[model samples]
Target: MKKFTAHKKRVAITTAALVAIGGGAAFAYWTSTGSGTGSATTGTTVPFTVTSTTATGGPLTPGGPSQVVEFEVTNPSTGVQRLQNVIVTVADEDGILWTDAGGCSYKDYFVSDAVFTAGDVAPNGGKVTGTVTIKMNNLATNQDACKGLAVPLHFSAS
Candidate 1:
Protein backbone atom coordinates (compact mmCIF):
# COMPACT_ATOMS: atom_id res chain seq x y z
CA MET A 1 0.00 0.00 0.00
CA LYS A 2 2.82 2.50 0.72
CA LYS A 3 4.46 1.85 -2.65
CA PHE A 4 1.17 2.44 -4.55
CA THR A 5 0.50 5.82 -2.75
CA ALA A 6 4.00 7.11 -3.63
CA HIS A 7 3.51 6.25 -7.33
CA LYS A 8 0.13 8.13 -7.54
CA LYS A 9 1.68 11.29 -5.98
CA ARG A 10 4.50 11.34 -8.60
CA VAL A 11 1.93 11.13 -11.51
CA ALA A 12 -0.13 14.08 -10.17
CA ILE A 13 2.96 16.35 -9.75
CA THR A 14 4.15 15.62 -13.32
CA THR A 15 0.73 16.49 -14.84
CA ALA A 16 0.62 19.91 -13.05
CA ALA A 17 4.13 20.73 -14.27
CA LEU A 18 3.22 19.93 -17.87
CA VAL A 19 0.04 22.16 -17.73
CA ALA A 20 2.03 25.14 -16.35
CA ILE A 21 4.66 24.84 -19.13
CA GLY A 22 2.03 24.65 -21.88
CA GLY A 23 0.10 27.68 -20.48
CA GLY A 24 3.29 29.80 -20.44
CA ALA A 25 4.02 28.87 -24.02
CA ALA A 26 0.51 29.98 -25.13
CA PHE A 27 1.12 33.57 -23.81
CA ALA A 28 4.50 34.03 -25.60
CA TYR A 29 4.85 36.19 -28.82
CA TRP A 30 7.61 37.16 -31.30
CA THR A 31 9.13 40.75 -31.40
CA SER A 32 10.01 42.37 -34.78
CA THR A 33 10.81 45.75 -36.64
CA GLY A 34 9.48 47.06 -40.01
CA SER A 35 9.38 50.19 -42.40
CA GLY A 36 7.29 51.61 -45.35
CA THR A 37 6.96 54.63 -47.76
CA GLY A 38 4.13 57.04 -48.75
CA SER A 39 3.47 60.14 -50.96
CA ALA A 40 0.95 63.06 -51.54
CA THR A 41 0.05 65.68 -54.26
CA THR A 42 -0.63 69.46 -54.23
CA GLY A 43 -3.04 71.82 -56.01
CA THR A 44 -2.43 74.66 -58.57
CA THR A 45 -3.53 78.30 -58.62
CA VAL A 46 -5.83 80.08 -61.13
CA PRO A 47 -5.96 83.69 -62.38
CA PHE A 48 -8.48 86.38 -61.39
CA THR A 49 -10.90 88.11 -63.79
CA VAL A 50 -11.06 91.91 -63.83
CA THR A 51 -13.72 93.98 -65.63
CA SER A 52 -14.63 97.67 -65.91
CA THR A 53 -17.86 98.52 -64.06
CA THR A 54 -18.56 102.22 -64.64
CA ALA A 55 -16.98 105.54 -65.59
CA THR A 56 -17.72 108.77 -63.73
CA GLY A 57 -16.59 112.37 -64.53
CA GLY A 58 -16.35 111.96 -68.26
CA PRO A 59 -17.22 114.11 -71.24
CA LEU A 60 -13.62 113.26 -72.21
CA THR A 61 -12.77 116.37 -74.14
CA PRO A 62 -9.13 117.32 -74.72
CA GLY A 63 -7.72 118.72 -71.46
CA GLY A 64 -11.20 118.27 -70.00
CA PRO A 65 -12.13 116.77 -66.61
CA SER A 66 -10.62 113.39 -65.85
CA GLN A 67 -12.92 110.35 -65.53
CA VAL A 68 -12.99 108.11 -62.46
CA VAL A 69 -12.80 104.55 -63.74
CA GLU A 70 -14.51 102.01 -61.44
CA PHE A 71 -13.84 98.30 -61.87
CA GLU A 72 -14.65 94.94 -60.22
CA VAL A 73 -12.45 91.86 -59.78
CA THR A 74 -13.73 88.27 -59.71
CA ASN A 75 -11.76 85.56 -57.94
CA PRO A 76 -12.47 82.29 -59.75
CA SER A 77 -10.02 80.29 -57.67
CA THR A 78 -10.85 77.83 -54.90
CA GLY A 79 -8.95 79.88 -52.29
CA VAL A 80 -8.77 83.50 -51.19
CA GLN A 81 -6.33 85.83 -52.97
CA ARG A 82 -4.63 89.21 -52.31
CA LEU A 83 -5.01 92.22 -54.58
CA GLN A 84 -2.26 94.84 -54.49
CA ASN A 85 -3.13 97.19 -57.33
CA VAL A 86 -4.81 97.46 -60.72
CA ILE A 87 -2.96 98.68 -63.82
CA VAL A 88 -5.11 100.50 -66.36
CA THR A 89 -4.15 100.86 -69.99
CA VAL A 90 -5.71 101.40 -73.40
CA ALA A 91 -6.37 98.28 -75.44
CA ASP A 92 -4.23 98.11 -78.54
CA GLU A 93 -6.95 97.84 -81.15
CA ASP A 94 -6.00 99.05 -84.61
CA GLY A 95 -9.69 99.16 -85.56
CA ILE A 96 -10.30 102.28 -83.43
CA LEU A 97 -11.46 105.13 -85.70
CA TRP A 98 -12.26 108.65 -84.58
CA THR A 99 -15.61 110.27 -85.33
CA ASP A 100 -13.79 112.60 -87.73
CA ALA A 101 -11.41 111.49 -90.49
CA GLY A 102 -8.49 112.94 -88.47
CA GLY A 103 -6.16 110.46 -86.72
CA CYS A 104 -6.52 109.51 -83.02
CA SER A 105 -4.31 106.97 -81.26
CA TYR A 106 -3.68 105.53 -77.78
CA LYS A 107 -0.89 108.13 -77.36
CA ASP A 108 -3.53 110.87 -77.04
CA TYR A 109 -4.97 109.32 -73.85
CA PHE A 110 -3.67 108.91 -70.29
CA VAL A 111 -4.84 106.36 -67.69
CA SER A 112 -3.64 106.55 -64.09
CA ASP A 113 -2.60 103.26 -62.54
CA ALA A 114 -4.39 102.44 -59.26
CA VAL A 115 -2.41 101.44 -56.15
CA PHE A 116 -4.08 100.31 -52.91
CA THR A 117 -3.73 97.51 -50.37
CA ALA A 118 -7.13 95.97 -50.89
CA GLY A 119 -8.67 93.25 -48.72
CA ASP A 120 -8.32 89.58 -49.69
CA VAL A 121 -11.00 88.40 -52.07
CA ALA A 122 -13.13 85.43 -51.06
CA PRO A 123 -13.03 82.12 -52.94
CA ASN A 124 -15.20 81.25 -55.95
CA GLY A 125 -16.79 84.29 -57.65
CA GLY A 126 -15.91 86.76 -54.91
CA LYS A 127 -15.82 90.41 -55.98
CA VAL A 128 -14.05 93.66 -54.92
CA THR A 129 -14.12 97.20 -56.33
CA GLY A 130 -11.34 99.62 -57.32
CA THR A 131 -10.90 102.82 -59.30
CA VAL A 132 -8.48 104.57 -61.67
CA THR A 133 -8.55 107.86 -63.57
CA ILE A 134 -8.50 108.48 -67.33
CA LYS A 135 -8.13 111.65 -69.33
CA MET A 136 -7.30 112.82 -72.83
CA ASN A 137 -4.04 114.67 -72.47
CA ASN A 138 -4.13 118.12 -74.01
CA LEU A 139 -1.78 117.97 -77.00
CA ALA A 140 -0.71 121.12 -78.86
CA THR A 141 -2.20 119.77 -82.09
CA ASN A 142 -5.88 119.85 -83.11
CA GLN A 143 -7.73 117.65 -80.54
CA ASP A 144 -10.94 117.35 -82.56
CA ALA A 145 -9.79 113.90 -83.84
CA CYS A 146 -10.96 112.17 -80.61
CA LYS A 147 -14.35 113.87 -80.33
CA GLY A 148 -17.42 111.64 -79.80
CA LEU A 149 -15.33 108.45 -79.62
CA ALA A 150 -15.50 105.71 -77.02
CA VAL A 151 -12.13 104.65 -75.61
CA PRO A 152 -11.42 101.01 -74.76
CA LEU A 153 -9.63 100.39 -71.45
CA HIS A 154 -7.73 97.31 -70.30
CA PHE A 155 -7.48 96.27 -66.63
CA SER A 156 -4.97 93.92 -64.91
CA ALA A 157 -4.38 92.99 -61.24
CA SER A 158 -1.87 91.17 -59.05
Candidate 2:
Protein backbone atom coordinates (compact mmCIF):
# COMPACT_ATOMS: atom_id res chain seq x y z
CA MET A 1 0.00 0.00 0.00
CA LYS A 2 1.59 3.17 -1.20
CA LYS A 3 0.23 6.67 -0.83
CA PHE A 4 -1.76 7.85 -3.89
CA THR A 5 -1.03 11.51 -4.79
CA ALA A 6 -3.16 13.82 -7.03
CA HIS A 7 -0.47 13.84 -9.75
CA LYS A 8 -0.26 10.03 -9.74
CA LYS A 9 -4.05 9.78 -9.82
CA ARG A 10 -4.21 12.12 -12.80
CA VAL A 11 -1.52 10.15 -14.67
CA ALA A 12 -3.39 6.87 -13.99
CA ILE A 13 -6.63 8.35 -15.25
CA THR A 14 -4.93 9.67 -18.42
CA THR A 15 -3.33 6.29 -19.12
CA ALA A 16 -6.69 4.52 -18.66
CA ALA A 17 -8.36 6.95 -21.08
CA LEU A 18 -5.61 6.38 -23.67
CA VAL A 19 -5.95 2.60 -23.39
CA ALA A 20 -9.72 2.78 -23.78
CA ILE A 21 -9.42 4.96 -26.88
CA GLY A 22 -6.87 2.60 -28.44
CA GLY A 23 -9.11 -0.42 -27.84
CA GLY A 24 -12.07 1.31 -29.45
CA ALA A 25 -9.99 2.29 -32.49
CA ALA A 26 -8.89 -1.33 -32.96
CA PHE A 27 -12.56 -2.42 -33.21
CA ALA A 28 -13.58 0.42 -35.63
CA TYR A 29 -13.58 0.19 -39.42
CA TRP A 30 -11.14 2.21 -41.54
CA THR A 31 -11.54 3.55 -45.05
CA SER A 32 -9.11 5.08 -47.55
CA THR A 33 -9.39 6.53 -51.06
CA GLY A 34 -6.90 6.32 -53.94
CA SER A 35 -6.78 6.79 -57.70
CA GLY A 36 -4.90 5.17 -60.59
CA THR A 37 -4.63 5.57 -64.34
CA GLY A 38 -6.56 3.20 -66.66
CA SER A 39 -7.47 2.90 -70.25
CA ALA A 40 -10.31 1.47 -72.45
CA THR A 41 -9.94 0.57 -76.09
CA THR A 42 -12.59 -0.07 -78.75
CA GLY A 43 -12.71 -3.06 -81.06
CA THR A 44 -11.84 -2.87 -84.78
CA THR A 45 -14.37 -2.94 -87.57
CA VAL A 46 -14.76 -5.93 -89.89
CA PRO A 47 -15.16 -5.72 -93.67
CA PHE A 48 -17.71 -7.59 -95.74
CA THR A 49 -17.57 -8.23 -99.49
CA VAL A 50 -19.86 -9.77 -102.05
CA THR A 51 -17.76 -12.28 -103.95
CA SER A 52 -20.07 -13.18 -106.85
CA THR A 53 -23.70 -12.98 -107.94
CA THR A 54 -25.39 -15.29 -110.43
CA ALA A 55 -28.91 -15.75 -111.67
CA THR A 56 -30.47 -18.77 -113.40
CA GLY A 57 -32.39 -18.52 -116.66
CA GLY A 58 -31.37 -15.08 -117.88
CA PRO A 59 -33.10 -13.06 -120.67
CA LEU A 60 -36.18 -14.09 -118.73
CA THR A 61 -39.01 -15.24 -121.02
CA PRO A 62 -42.43 -14.64 -119.49
CA GLY A 63 -44.31 -17.79 -118.41
CA GLY A 64 -41.33 -19.73 -119.69
CA PRO A 65 -39.09 -20.95 -116.86
CA SER A 66 -38.68 -20.44 -113.14
CA GLN A 67 -35.62 -18.38 -112.22
CA VAL A 68 -33.21 -18.47 -109.30
CA VAL A 69 -30.67 -16.01 -107.88
CA GLU A 70 -27.59 -17.15 -106.01
CA PHE A 71 -24.91 -15.02 -104.43
CA GLU A 72 -21.77 -15.47 -102.34
CA VAL A 73 -20.71 -13.33 -99.38
CA THR A 74 -17.39 -13.15 -97.58
CA ASN A 75 -16.40 -11.94 -94.12
CA PRO A 76 -12.96 -10.57 -93.35
CA SER A 77 -13.44 -10.46 -89.59
CA THR A 78 -11.31 -12.11 -86.93
CA GLY A 79 -14.44 -13.42 -85.24
CA VAL A 80 -17.46 -15.26 -86.55
CA GLN A 81 -20.11 -13.03 -88.10
CA ARG A 82 -23.73 -13.80 -87.36
CA LEU A 83 -26.02 -12.62 -90.13
CA GLN A 84 -29.57 -11.72 -89.23
CA ASN A 85 -31.03 -11.03 -92.64
CA VAL A 86 -30.19 -11.03 -96.37
CA ILE A 87 -32.20 -8.44 -98.29
CA VAL A 88 -32.74 -8.98 -102.03
CA THR A 89 -33.94 -6.30 -104.38
CA VAL A 90 -34.31 -5.99 -108.15
CA ALA A 91 -33.28 -2.79 -109.88
CA ASP A 92 -33.07 -1.41 -113.43
CA GLU A 93 -35.79 -3.92 -114.41
CA ASP A 94 -39.18 -3.63 -116.05
CA GLY A 95 -42.81 -3.88 -114.87
CA ILE A 96 -44.03 -5.15 -111.50
CA LEU A 97 -42.81 -8.75 -110.94
CA TRP A 98 -44.55 -11.28 -108.77
CA THR A 99 -43.98 -14.94 -107.91
CA ASP A 100 -47.52 -16.27 -108.27
CA ALA A 101 -48.73 -18.32 -111.27
CA GLY A 102 -50.10 -15.28 -113.06
CA GLY A 103 -46.90 -13.58 -111.95
CA CYS A 104 -43.29 -14.86 -112.52
CA SER A 105 -43.22 -18.52 -111.45
CA TYR A 106 -46.18 -20.83 -111.32
CA LYS A 107 -44.31 -23.33 -109.13
CA ASP A 108 -42.37 -21.01 -106.79
CA TYR A 109 -42.41 -17.46 -105.44
CA PHE A 110 -40.75 -15.27 -102.81
CA VAL A 111 -42.74 -15.03 -99.59
CA SER A 112 -40.55 -12.29 -98.16
CA ASP A 113 -37.92 -9.80 -99.22
CA ALA A 114 -35.43 -11.36 -96.83
CA VAL A 115 -34.42 -14.81 -98.07
CA PHE A 116 -31.98 -16.03 -95.39
CA THR A 117 -32.39 -16.94 -91.75
CA ALA A 118 -29.89 -16.30 -88.95
CA GLY A 119 -26.59 -17.92 -89.97
CA ASP A 120 -22.96 -17.68 -88.96
CA VAL A 121 -20.31 -16.81 -91.49
CA ALA A 122 -16.74 -17.85 -90.75
CA PRO A 123 -14.18 -15.15 -90.05
CA ASN A 124 -11.09 -14.24 -92.06
CA GLY A 125 -11.77 -15.11 -95.69
CA GLY A 126 -14.82 -17.06 -94.66
CA LYS A 127 -17.64 -17.50 -97.16
CA VAL A 128 -21.40 -18.01 -97.08
CA THR A 129 -23.97 -18.58 -99.80
CA GLY A 130 -27.62 -17.64 -100.20
CA THR A 131 -30.28 -18.17 -102.87
CA VAL A 132 -33.73 -16.86 -103.77
CA THR A 133 -36.46 -17.88 -106.16
CA ILE A 134 -37.59 -15.17 -108.56
CA LYS A 135 -39.74 -14.84 -111.65
CA MET A 136 -41.08 -12.32 -114.13
CA ASN A 137 -44.74 -11.57 -114.70
CA ASN A 138 -46.72 -14.66 -115.83
CA LEU A 139 -49.46 -13.14 -117.96
CA ALA A 140 -51.47 -13.93 -121.08
CA THR A 141 -48.80 -12.28 -123.27
CA ASN A 142 -45.27 -10.98 -122.70
CA GLN A 143 -45.16 -7.22 -122.15
CA ASP A 144 -42.41 -5.30 -123.90
CA ALA A 145 -41.90 -3.33 -120.66
CA CYS A 146 -40.49 -6.57 -119.20
CA LYS A 147 -38.01 -7.33 -121.94
CA GLY A 148 -34.25 -7.90 -121.79
CA LEU A 149 -33.79 -4.73 -119.74
CA ALA A 150 -30.59 -5.87 -117.95
CA VAL A 151 -32.10 -5.38 -114.54
CA PRO A 152 -29.44 -5.41 -111.82
CA LEU A 153 -29.86 -7.26 -108.55
CA HIS A 154 -28.72 -5.92 -105.20
CA PHE A 155 -28.08 -7.92 -102.03
CA SER A 156 -27.21 -6.79 -98.52
CA ALA A 157 -26.79 -8.54 -95.18
CA SER A 158 -26.88 -7.48 -91.58
For model 2, the stretches where C-alpha displacement exceeds 4 angstroms are 1-35, 92-117, 139-142
Candidate 2 lDDT, tens digit per residue, 1-158? 24568778889999999989987785567899999999998667675676445666655655566567776778888888877777665532332343332333322223235454468888887887777766655566545555544445556667
In TM-score terms, candidate 1 sits at: 0.71
Tens digits of per-residue lDDT, candidate 1, 1-158, equal 88899999999889989988987775668999999998897657678888776688859888889988888888999888887777777764333422334677677888887744488989999988778898998999887778887777777777
The TM-score between candidate 2 and the true structure equals 0.55
Per TM-score, the best of the predicted structures is: 1
RMSD of each: 5.9, 10.1
Local error of candidate 2 at residue 33 (angstroms): 7.3
- Per-residue error (Å), model 2, residue 45: 4.0
TM-score of each: 0.71, 0.55
lDDT of 1 at 76: 95
Q: What is the Cα root-mean-square deviation between model 2 and the actual structure?
A: 10.1
Residue 5 of model 1 has an lDDT of 92
